[model samples]
Target: MIKLYIKQAFYQLRENRLISLVSIIGTALAICMIMVIVLVLEVRITDCVPEVNR
Candidate 1:
């Protein structure tokens, strides 16, 4: 079953290389943007705390 699934995946990849590339690029960009936003929010939250309380 796994072998059959792999074969089908390869066939589709060969048949639609451009579509596959675009999908990968779009997913990567989305993940990168999400990480950047999360990191910025984390830094801002941490920086807002006053150091004298600690």
Candidate 2:
């Protein structure tokens, strides 16, 4: 069940604190990097034209 899987993950994270911290930070950094890239692409495509607004 999902509960068991979550409990197992919690225990694993608790047992290896350093590894868990590193893994969590890495995942967060990767997600943030992806979001920044997506935002940059959106801005570049939407706001790059000068004559569109004026």
Candidate 3:
């Protein structure tokens, strides 16, 4: 089940501290980069004011 997977993950993290730290930091950075890219695209594609002509 999901609980078993989580328990195993914690055990691995505790067993390998350096690898766990690197992987956790890498995952966080990747997530932040993706979010920034999506937000930038959203701002560029949306219009704040009305356009009179096409």
Worst 10 residues of 2 by lDDT: 45-54
Report clash pairs, candidate 3.
none
Per-residue alpha-carbon lDDT of model 3 for 19-43, expressed as tens digits? 9999999999999999999999999
Tens-digit lDDT track of model 1 for 1-54: 999999998998899999988988999999999999999999987867579577
Global local distance difference test of model 1: 0.92
Q: Which regions of candidate 3 are displaced past 4 Å?
A: 50-54
Best by TM-score: 2
Q: Under the 3 Å rule for N, CA and C atoms, how many clashes does model 2 have?
A: 0
Question: Which candidate leads the pack in lDDT?
Answer: 3
Off by over 4 Å in 1: 1-3, 48-51
TM-score of each: 0.73, 0.84, 0.82
Per-residue lDDT of model 2, residues 1-54, tens digit only: 999999999999999999999999999999999999999999888866679866
lDDT of each: 0.92, 0.94, 0.96
